[model samples]
Target: MSKKQKRVLIRILISSVLFAAGEVLIITGSNPFNEASLFAFFLIPYLIVGGDVLLDAIKNIIRGQIFDENFLMALATIGAFAIGEYPEGVAVMLFYQIGELFQSYAVNASRKSIASLMDIRPDYANIEIDGVLKQVDPEEVSVGDIIIVKPGERIPLDGVVKEGTSSVDTSALTGESLPRDLSEGNEALSGCINLNGVLSIQVTKEFGESTVSKILDLVENASSKKAKAENFITKFARYYTPVVVIGAALLAIIPPLLIDGALFSEWIQRALIFLVVSCPCALVISIPLGFFGGIGGASKCGVLIKGSNYLEVLAKTGMVVFDKTGTLTKGNFKVTEIYPAKGATIHKDEILKLAATAESYSDHPISTSLKEAYGIKIDRKQLESVEEISGYGVKAIVDGKRVYVGNAKLMEQCSIDFERKTTPGTLVYVAIENSYAGCIVIADEIKEDSADAVVNLKNAGVKRTIMLTGDSKAVGKMVAEELGLDEVYAELLPADKVNQLEELIKQKRLYGNLAFVGDGINDAPVLAEADVGIAMGGLGSDAAIEAADIVIMDDRPSKIVTAIEISRKTLKIVKQNIILALGIKGIVLLLGAFGMATMWEAVFADVGVSVIAILNAMRALDVSRYQG
Candidate 1:
């Protein structure tokens, strides 16, 4: 618990004890009204519990802010004291304090969860000066400086590893369980832990431009962007408070003057009840609390909701658009199928081996997949004069025989007749001595949870799932079919992707809103253009994450379903509180004005409804029950 919460709790305990002691004395034989000593004794506990409230009411009155809960509460309790109902006045203040404590506690709990996210801020950096390592503030380190990170230290800024190798625990940023292995020439982001082995990194970004700094800035400023529901409540309270105060004042004055035999004291009591019942505490306290809890719960699951407004819109999403590479697929090329052309003398294994040998000296993704598939170490001495034909493939002499590995363009260029194959991947054609050999199909592997992600999204009421990719139409169609997507738009440039998303958003407008998910630097614009921009924070570019309203920290598309579920549940809770508070207060207000309800019922309508609504709002924090 926070210190402020502890103090509120302590005040609650003290007030409760004093109120109990005062009640005991009243029941034992002390006449509060007749005996000065007894009245002072009872008044002591009332002042102990309500002194602060009365002082706040006076301050608000002096500042021209007279129509609020504090003012209403002070007016009602003091009116009860004037009527010699000391016990009722004391009870009203006591329960009001109790409700305030609950609100304070709930808000504090949410702030703590968000504060935990801010813990990723790095404190210092270790820079080498003349072969001596010195720890200094991370801001002092500049780009291109070599910073040494030891075991169990957070990487202070974004950089590339120049020396040594280690595993980095990226769970704090990504929310994944696996540690990413890092070696020389690999990029390392800030806010990740270097697990073991010393590493010398060449910094590529300043502290302000680093990934951690950007994320922290985004989170800290999130609450300034309020949801529609929150804005409605603010406007409602502003108008509602003043209207009820005027009505209560009219009730106290007009009834006694117009109606014969209507005593001023009795009418004043009814007006006081009206004021208490119309405080609007329940709606005012619970709506923002519900949204705050939703954001906190999303953070716990590695889904950072930038604001309640996005959370609200996410719940209304009917269509979900995705970028194929890095968002739906693993973005890593792998050899999934190998086919040899008809009439080829060489076997399937030989085709792969030759292609692997020709591409062994290359560092392309397709080349890496071929080498990994070969599984046998290549002897560089046997390969001679490897030459890369841009946009086609590679040419090299392997085992004293000239080998060629590339696409159909390469075959057409060499006038070598090759058999065409139907497959949804990047096919690398092989040839020896200008004769057609075979082909190897390499593709970006789909993530394991992608299929499940689609299923869960449909179950969560997502009407359409679409994919946009820069790959061939064949590859895009294959992935769309595999993932059960509704539509696929392929061969798109970054601008084409944005246009396609805009069209989809327009098409889906009649049904509901649309959400776009992506994870590359190229995806930043589309991420911002969508109804709700969701970025894969774990491996995503900083630009993409910054433009996004929601970030999936673990880079799992399935978490999109989880985020939608959380927003929907939070909206449900908020609506429940609003209806419950308004419904009950509407009926109680009529009863109080008609003199049918007593001060006890007015207290329940004021404090009791607030407490119940707050408890319901707290349900948004228990997000574990939501499996999606």
Candidate 2:
């Protein structure tokens, strides 16, 4: 318990002892004072437990902020004392204080659960000067600085490993417990704990731009964006409190004056009970707490939701559209097969050699794959004229022979007769000395979890699973068929992708949202255009991440399904809290107004309902059951 809560506990104990003593004296017929003196004696315990609440009500009244929970509580208890009900008044305040203590503890626990992610903030960076390591604040560390991280220390900046090798724990950032191994020349992100060996890292980004800083900024500002349900509760409390307060006052005064033989004390007691039951504390506290717990739980699963508003929208997702490369498939291209033309003098190795040599100077992904497949040094002395034809391929003279390396379009442009391959990959046709030589097939590999992601989405009740890609129709069809996507739009440019997404958006169900998933710089436009933009944080460009509403830290498509599940579960819990709080309060409120309930029932309506709803909200933070 916090110190403030400790003080409240101490006050509660003292007041309870005093209250019990007075009741024992009254029951034993040993009361030492008259009615006036007894009232003064009971005032001591009432003020002890509820002084702050009365003081707050007075302050808010003076500041023109009436009709809050404190005001309702103070007014109800004070009216009890006016009607000579000293013990009942004291009991109401004591139980209300206990409820307040429960709320304080619950809120603190929820903050700690979410703030666990803030533990990733590094305290200092270790810099070497004059052959000795010196600790400096992370903000003082600049780009291009070399920082040394010891075993069991958190990495302070984003950098590449200059020397040493070790496994680093990325659980704080990626929410995965597995430790990633790093060697020399490998990229090391900040906020990861160096587990086993000391690592010398060359910094690539400044402290402000590091991954840790970005994530911290995202988490700290998450609560500012509230969901529609939370907003409704805020407005509801604002208007509901004043209306109930006025109703309670009319109930106290008008009934006794108009009804013959209606005792004023009995009607007044009923009005006090009505005020206590209608405090609106349960609805005011639990709704926002539930949404916050949901966001924290998602962070624990490697998904960063920008706000609760997006969490609300994700629960109603009807269609999920994906960008093929870097989102569903690994963007790395590799040579999967090789085919030499029939009746050609060139062998498979020779065909690869000529293709790799002709495309040596180019830096395209297909060129890099060809060079890696060739696995030999290209002697540029064998080349004479090298020319790149846009929309085609590369034309060069290799070993005193004219070599043309490009697509089937390039072959037709040069009038070279080549056998077209029907394989599901990017086929690169090659021609030497104006004759067909061979074809090398390059393909991007699919991610392991992508198929599971599709299956889970369908199981989760997503109506449409679609893919939008800039790859050829054949390659796109192959990946879509393998993943069992409901729809596929292929061979599109960046603008064309947005157009296709817009068309898909029009086809979604009413009250349902569409989400676009992409990871490239060109994907920024389409990501922004979607109802919810999900970016693959790992290996994704800065533009895409900036435009996205949610980020998947480890680039697993399956986590998207996890996010949807978390969102729907959160929405369910919030609805339950709303119904639970309002349902119990409504029944007791009507009973209190009709004189059918007493002060104890009023306490249960306000305090008991709040505690139950708060405990239910805390369940949103337990996401372990949702993880694989």
Candidate 3:
């Protein structure tokens, strides 16, 4: 399928053929115990398998890229050959190439996982022109353009159903399993296929801003943001290689004169063993591979980690901060309670409709949700002379009558005689002809999983979980208590939230890292300041995702805990590999120095340790074992 794949197959083929021939030669008694001939037979296929690897090492040495794995491997094997250990030389090279191939396949597998995630890209878009079906580029389409979609096709842009109905699968974006049912006038997202029904949609956004493009872009570039830990090994090898090479030279020459005429073969043989033992295979290959595995594994769970540096920070976060609106609570405002004044003829719906209609001409959160609940589109013609007062609300002349929709302060300014209802939420009062009609109590409620997320974070080992919100003290306290949070601050402006995060970070500085999770344009400042900036609901503004170090694709705050769990697990694997690699290397290096170990031991130190570390790195695949 690829050049690397084809070459690996070729190497295996050559190794298999030569191996069989070598066994026949031994059995036929042409050379029953001629280890050199047996070694020659073994080395022929081994060289065919790994000749390119050896050549590359020599090329790099000539090109001044002298301190690399290839040079170390080449020097070690050639030294063995010079010491008249031909079979050992070939065996060492053969196993070293096998280890290199293992790491190569690991890289390919990681790319495939990310590619599967990116495959969510929609293949085509539907365009409606002159009452006829035609295909068009999604970029050429604009808002309000009608697009026809057949059954089992993905919608290329965010749009409303101008015609037709179907079940659309959204698992690509949210990891959600259910297929959502769509009807006329309902909105559908990109990356979702129209299943079992012909559909037409009015385009809402351009192709670049569509969910599919954003997701694919995010995943494709995920590896770029998150660098592997191997960078440290490269730096370590730069210094470590030359120092060890000099040490081996000293071991070869210095001991000979000091011992009153050291034998040439014995000293050179010991130096060769020293060279094999000091290949630095364990530190060079496994440490960084551990971090790469961690990052790739977390990506499979939709956590966009920016780098290993952040993964390290996340592993040590003892205190975590959160923004209230859109982070802890749902950003949408809802009518919590409706209070009707004495002798009012209107029920709750009638009061809601009047309020919805008065503010229908304006585009605001309170107005939008009110209009949504009315189940009727706003008639702009009926709404006349609409004027919005900044920091207040909108007032307009409708149906030859003046209508008002605003807070208690707006009502007080207008001298409306309406009784205020003391409640645990914001109160939107309605007035007709400057006379109070009724009030609708509204609040941005806590998300259903918010409390569970706090609990899970605690179980995930966070020492303290905090909430900082712009809402009133009562509302903030209610949510914090419900979620069983450790701390909370209410009625904070954007700057106040940052200041609070600063103080908490200072207090928690002694313990470990402090993480802040937010999904608001205003939260960008604080998100950048935290040790680990995690943004919930990455579908939020780019200002939020770009400012934060980690982005959760799903709105669930529980994913924050999942990310922490993943980081901890990843770090644990890294530690395990380090210990295993170093421990094995240490034992063999001592034995190699004393001539108690053979070339096989050197193979284990170089190639065998690498294979074990790689197998350990693949443990990052089982995310379910780490996630709660």
**lDDT of each candidate versus the true structure:** 0.79, 0.80, 0.71
Say which prediction, candidate 2 or candidate 3, comes out ahead on lDDT. 2
Candidate No. with top lDDT:
2
How far residue 453's Cα lies from its native spot in candidate 1, in Å, is: 2.2
lDDT of 1 by residue, 1-628 (tens): 7787687677767877877877787788763546566557657777877788899989988999876667776776776676556666777777667656554554344222333434678999999888889999999999999999999999999999999877787644543223556778999989889876799999999999987776565544432332233455445646776787789889999999999999998888788778667766676567767887898888889988876777789999999999887889887778998877786668889888888988998765677889999999988898998887654567899998898898887888888888888798877888899888888888888999999999999998999999987677998899999999999998765556766877887786576888989886556557667778899989876666766778999999999999999999999999999899989999999998888898778768877887899899889988886544
| Model 2 TM-score relative to the real fold | 0.62
Which candidate order results from sorting by lDDT in descending order?
A: 2, 1, 3
Clashes of each: 1, 0, 1
lDDT of 3 by residue, 287-320 (tens): 5566667766777788777666677789998998
Runs in model 2 lying further than 4 Å from the true structure:
1-230, 235-247, 261-266, 343-347, 376-392, 395-402, 408-415, 420-425, 472-474, 491-503, 508-511, 594-600
Q: What are the TM-scores, per candidate, against the unseen true structure?
A: 0.67, 0.62, 0.63
Q: Report RMSD for candidate 1.
A: 8.6
Q: What is the lDDT of residue 484 in candidate 2?
A: 98
For candidate 1, list the clashing residue pairs, or say none: 562-628
Better of 1 and 3 by TM-score: 1
Residue 346, candidate 1: Cα error in Å is 1.7
